[model samples]
Target: MSGEAAPALGVLRRREFRLLFSAQAVSVLGDRMVAVALAFAVLEIGGSVADVGLVLAAGTFPLVATVLVGGVVADRVSRRAVMVAADLVRVASQGAMAALLIAGVAEVWMLALLAAVAGAATGFFGPASTGLLPEVVLAEQLQPANALRASAVSAGEILGPILAGVLVAAAGAGWAIAVDAVTFAVSAACLLALRVTPRAREQQSAFAVDLRAGWDAFRSRRWVWTFVAYFSLVNLLWGAWGTLGPIVAEQDLGGAAAWGAILTAMGVGALAGSLLAARVRPSRPLLLAAFTDSLFALPLAFLAATSSVPLIACGAFLAGAGMALTISIWESTLQRHIPGESLSRVSSYDWFGSLAFYPLGLAIWGPIAAAIGVGTSLWLSFGMAAAMTLALLSVPDIRRLPVAPPVAGEATP
Candidate 1:
């Protein structure tokens, strides 16, 4: 909450953090390309908008189903080992998809199946990666480290779509996906080169018992649930944007290119926001974060209420900014507040709760849109997201989340 700028660049200069950053950056590029290729591949194979929905939902479901287990694994096993395994699994799965497409034998089911597998790996990877950050960087640098990651992700999102558009148009989606698979391999290599020591596992238990212990951590925290409940509602609304927004773009807004622009603008905004977050920490971290989430729905309101490119772009930018701010605060709070041993498990619970309804939102939004209208669906999403933000901000615990004092030992966790 201090006005002084945090030394974000100084943290990046640390050798171990640099390695982690490099690996994450490489992996993010591949991740973004997968999104681009998946959407295009569905369209190329004569799949409907509904098929796209199914593919995306399939990809996201693993996070909801496996996150808790992933957390337990992160807490019990070496975080580096878990990350290495995840990267390898992604490489194999993505490579198979590329080969299938190259053979001209690709099917929607294959795409969906591969996506699900990759998602499961990511479910584990996300928690481990998040939990591992404090181990690699100074406690005071947590916000900046997270900001750098957000910027990297935004950079990938911005470039991947444009690259995929061009690559799929010229070389085919299969080749584009192959490029993504290669990036994963490179990411693994970067991670393997890290020099940091893994945290010693002081206490161990059966996996089932550890799972229950993680649950206990969640049950003990009021702020944790307040954040999770609000995000659950926010993510449900996002599911509508994810499932229907692209279809609306193709049919009503403009086309794939238009959607790409909208998304790219948001990515750029996210990068800007991340950079801003590195220097500015909010006093009311949760309140600011939840309130900013409402901006995500602004574009929906604009698109639903009227058709204007500039307005939509504006809304998307604001939403992206909000997302960027929220990520930094949320990650820092979780790292600082939760017991390091139980951090990943608590994170898994947060992930599961926040995203549990996303697929449901995606699945139901299509039918709801068909029944009433896409515009009406947009209106409904706007209202829902706004309501969730308000409800989250109204919680006394959310408004009172404690910022942990700086650790007195070495900056490393």
Candidate 2:
């Protein structure tokens, strides 16, 4: 086949890619559902706004704490096995959460504890997932592979919340959460079935030594850490939005259904963006990605400024498109530039840096909003997001990082 004409769609022909893709598709749908279910469940149990923030923080903090260690372990052991174990843990956590809610015996502390377990599992899952993609797809197909993954997540985002709204309205948040539990089970089964080619094992080293190596790899790259620092601020704003956006919908906008609609619109936008990213190869991928990230602030600004659903949804759509584009390019960039052996560890550091303030943001947003109205808090979030993006643009490496050309005989999309 001609180099440029090799089927871009051929990546799906691989058994492992298909399995991984299906697993992520099912799991992300459940994750989106739980995002709605868990938020409403906190509210349903007579929990205050601050309580919702606390519960989210309870989950996120542990995930942040454990992710670096999880990354180290993933690099040492079977990545697939680590993912399967993580999926099982989430399955149990969500199952317990669902049962408690169904029995009308759910308490705030109980929910928080279960959420923490699930979050810890996610810490391991995220790094392993970042590392595992390179094992499944050709090096030349990394962009499309990442785009396909984004596409699966986008599809889930589109369908999951709408289903969650229906399930929560028709049955209860418990039933919606139960669906999340089932999806994890499905994900575990898919992981179990994947037959990954094992890589040459590195010599066993002390845990601290391995961690230091990972840290070195992460800090050595200016481009990697610069954006990681930027995203730390961005994620904080995201946490605030995730924590307060639903409250806004319930209080000012329509309700859960309205919130779901907004999320679905974002998903649709992300889906479109993923499709575009699969086809379009930018010369300065990082520069373009950073520029797009500034768009994230728009939805927050719109939400803060007005209660217009159409305008907010439009902003959300743009923001989602930007997010999908950023993620597709970012993952592909990392996979290409970082060595395979150290990739998971570096990814852990990336996750750790980006998520460092997420829990803090989640913990404080409710009280901040209470002290100075939700609208004001959202406006502040928008301001931070915009400022961070601009700061990232000022970094030379981030602004000028070009896509590495195709290697000899490697097909170009």
TM-score for all models, in order of appearance: 0.93, 0.96
Name the TM-score of candidate 2. Answer: 0.96
TM-score of 1: 0.93
- Give all candidates' CA lDDT scores: 0.80, 0.90
Residue-pair clashes per prediction, in order, are 0, 0
Q: Give a tens-digit lDDT track for model 2, residues 1-413.
A: 34432445678899999999999999999999888878888998899999889888888998999999999999999999999999999999999999999999999999999999999999999999999999999998898888889999999889998998888777788998999999999999999999999989978999999999999999988899999998888888888788998899889988888888888888998998887778767888899999877788888998898898889999989988989999999989999888999999999999999999999999989999999999899988988787888788888888677698467796432
Inter-residue clash pairs, candidate 2: none
Name the runs in model 1 displaced over 4 angstroms.
Answer: 1-6, 405-413
Model 1: per-residue Cα lDDT over 38-64, one tens digit each: 777877788776787788888889868
* Backbone clash pairs in model 2 (N, Cα, C under 3 Å; residues 3+ apart or in different chains), count: 0
